[model samples]
Target: MAVVNEGALKKMLKQYKYKDLTVREITNVISQYKDLKPVMDAYVFNDGSSRDLMSLTGTVPVSYRGGLENCL
Candidate 1:
């Protein structure tokens, strides 16, 4: 899993609270941080799959701690 800097992201979001931001805009900000770029690039989004949904079951399962790190 990618270790993102939550503090930095929260600060950025707070700054844009009054503005309407698109997903691409937010994604651009995320990609600006070197640490998260690799993880972001590793996945595909908006495909015709339940993985893009907001619910936990709809997204990719977190199996890193269950001896499936390599599979992810």
Candidate 2:
């Protein structure tokens, strides 16, 4: 498994090119942002990739897609 150092995590956030901020990055930055949760309710209709959220935030508790427990 690849460990995400602060620099690496910061790089990933930067790659997103978000001017304001992102929910994912917000979670990463503010660990107080309420712990693990998926990006479903955070969506309206098409919330983009469920897979990406899984990859970015790990399992995303109670998510139907399950966890990427195999990836590591």
List TM-score per model, in order.
0.23, 0.24
- Candidate 1: residue pairs that collide: none
Give the poorly placed runs of model 2, Cα more than 4 Å off. 1-6, 23-54, 63-72
Assess candidate 1 and give its lDDT.
Answer: 0.36
What lDDT score belongs to each candidate, Candidate 1 first? 0.36, 0.39
> What TM-score does model 1 achieve against the real structure?
0.23
Among all candidates shown, the one with the greatest lDDT:
2
The residue-by-residue lDDT of candidate 2 on 19-56, one tens digit each, is: 13564455553353233332322323475643222233
Show the colliding residue pairs in model 2: none
Measured over all alpha carbons after superposition, the RMSD of each candidate to the real structure, in angstroms, is 10.9, 10.0
lDDT of 1 at 25: 44
